[model samples]
Target: MSLLDASMNAIHLGFAGLWVGSVVFLTVAVLPLARDGAFDAAPLETVTSRLQWISRISALALFASGGHLAGTRYTVDSLTGSAPGYLVLTMLALWFLLALLVELGSKRLVGGFADRKVRQPAREARPYFLAASLVGVLLFLDAGLLSVPTAIPF
Candidate 1:
């Protein structure tokens, strides 16, 4: 009865893993190097832009398909009956909001970094990047831990 049967499940899992992996790599590995100024802004910005683009695309696909699946199966009662589903939904909303900020920062003005004359442009990047990584970690863990079948039959 689950429309997200095996093939759909596999696809969803793959997308989730890729998105989660990107965030983990950025958080656990890349951030420290950036903090140490191991690379210049130009190159760092390029990498961040590409990765975020990829992550956003994958997230869009995941959310779209997941929404369809949910609509086809779970009623409002079923949805509200569990802690995991609600938690995942809330976490995803937070992640999406954070992503919007990152997209604006990178696209509109590089967080005003394009205007190199400003003293605070580079500093602004640090906080945005940090928030992106932490939110990614939080949502990734929440989704994984919540998505599994954990019903205890008594």
Candidate 2:
């Protein structure tokens, strides 16, 4: 790979790792800490706020870097230049999926945090976050794998 490709890889990998790390922390540590009742409402709010901040930043980084990378590959007829093209496309699709879910779910979470009546069950948040994160990780992995330049005949 050229210098540009290497830098792009680093950007993509860094954002991917950050995004996954944020989700794992929130799901494994933050939520349990909040729900175990070890902390008061103020503390729980503090924890989720931090998690959300990290998540938003990481997501934006991933989105921005990913969009830049995708933009480089964009053609008049298509969105990807990577081979195993279907997989690459699927990977990009997950970014969109995560954006939508975070928009919807986070809004709901915020609404719930603001008012208990709309709050989804505490247990649900971890799973939802994990699912979204998992999707992201899969896409990241696929991009790393398929970005190689070898072309194999079927």
Candidate 3:
């Protein structure tokens, strides 16, 4: 690979790792701690907001780098017809789902806090967070798949 290709791949994978790690951390650590009352509403809100911000920025980076990688690696027909291409398409779908879940969940969580004068309960937030985190995990797995050679030659 050219230096430019290597750089783009690094950026893409870095952002992807950041996105996945943040989601996993929030879902596994933050939520459970908040649920157990280790973190009060105010601090939990701040942490959640910050995590959301990081997720947003990381997602943007991923999109940009992913686009560059896609352009370098794929043609339209090959992407649709090949195993690697299909994995890429699946990753794109997972990326979209992750974005949607994060956006809507953040809005709803923030709105509930505003309306109720308190953070949304962890139980209420759990499903959304879990779903988003699950998507992140799927993305990570898809990326791993992309790194390995497929049985079917493309």
Candidate 4:
């Protein structure tokens, strides 16, 4: 790979890992605490805001980097015709789902936090975050599959 391609790949992978990790952390750690009243509304609000920013930044970075990689490496025919291409498409779909879930979940938390309703908001947002975490895991698995040369039959 060219240096530019390598750099883009690094950025893509880095942001993907970061975003997924954040979702998992929120789901596994923060949300549970908030639901148990371990976190006050102000702290939970800050956490939600930071998560939103991370999700937004990561989404943009992945889009730009993935777009560059796709443009350089795949044609329309290949993308629609091959296993690796399908994985890429799957990653794209999962990326969108994860983004939407995070947004919805964060909105719920923020709204609740605004009213000093930590536990209720955390309770409401839990399902969305759980789904987002699952999608994030699947996204990483799809990416790992993409890296295996023999996994792609093209």
Candidate 5:
């Protein structure tokens, strides 16, 4: 790989890790606390805001780096015709789903926070976050599969 390709791959992986980690953290940690009324509205709001920012920034970074890597590494025919290409497409789909789920969950939390309702918002947002977490995990697994060499040539 060229240095530029390697750098883009690193950036892509880093942002993917960040995005997935943040979603998992929110789902596993923050949501439960918020649901239990452990956090006040202001703190919940701040947390949600930060989560949204992370999601948005990560989305953009992943898209840019992923696009570059894809463009350099695969042609339209290769992308459509190979197992690794399908995995890439799957990752792309998972990325979109993750982004959508996070956005929906954040909106729910923000809306509830606006009304000074922390627990309710957390409750409402829980399903979306849970789904996002699952998608994130799947995305990582797909990436790992893509990275491994097949015993038989494709």
Candidate 6:
């Protein structure tokens, strides 16, 4: 790989790490505290708002660098016709789903809090948090697979 490719890979991984790390932290740490009323909603809402911005930027980075990496490494045939291709395709779809979930979910949650000045019920927030965690897990697994030099048949 060229220096540019290496740089792009680094950027892509960095963004993925940030996005996944934040989601994991929110799901594993913050959400439970908020659910139990141990944490205040106002501050969490502010943090989520800022996190949404990071999510957006990282999503863009993922898209750009992932596209570059895919283009350089695989043709349409190989990308579609192989095991690694299928995994990559799944990862791409999950990435988009994650972006939508994080962006839209944060907006809805924050907006609800803003309008009512109250914390969202744990039951309501559970589904969103679970979805995010699932997406993060799958994305991380796919990334791990891709990182294996011998995993791709090419």
My TM-score estimates for the predictions, one after another, are: 0.68, 0.68, 0.88, 0.97, 0.95, 0.88
In Å, residue 107's CA in model 1 sits off its true spot by 5.4
> What lDDT score goes with residue 151 in model 5?
32
Cα deviation at 113, candidate 6, in Å, is 2.1
**Superposition error at 3 for model 6 (Å):** 0.4
TM-score of 3: 0.88
- Estimate candidate 5's alpha-carbon lDDT, on a 0 to 1 scale: 0.90
lDDT of 6 at 67: 97
Q: Between 2 and 5, whose TM-score is larger?
A: 5
Cα lDDT tens digits, model 3, 78-125, are: 789889999999998998898788776666556555444333466677
- Tell me, what's the RMSD of every candidate? 4.1, 3.9, 2.3, 1.2, 1.7, 2.3
Q: What are the Cα lDDT values of the candidates?
A: 0.61, 0.61, 0.78, 0.93, 0.90, 0.80
Candidate 6 residue-wise lDDT, 1-154, digit = tens: 8999999999999999999898878778877777676756677777687779878999899999999999999999988998788888999999989987787667656765745432564336657767987998999888777778476555
Which predicted model would earn the best lDDT? 4
User: In model 1, what is the error at residue 79, expressed in angstroms?
Assistant: 1.9
RMSD over all Cα atoms, model 2: 3.9
Per-residue CA lDDT of candidate 1, range 1-154, in tens? Answer: 4555655666766876776676556556765665565656676667677767877887787777667666665677767776655764665586576566566444532554354322244344556656766776676666656666574221
The numbered model that scores best in TM-score is 4
Clashes of each: 0, 0, 0, 0, 0, 0
State candidate 2's TM-score: 0.68
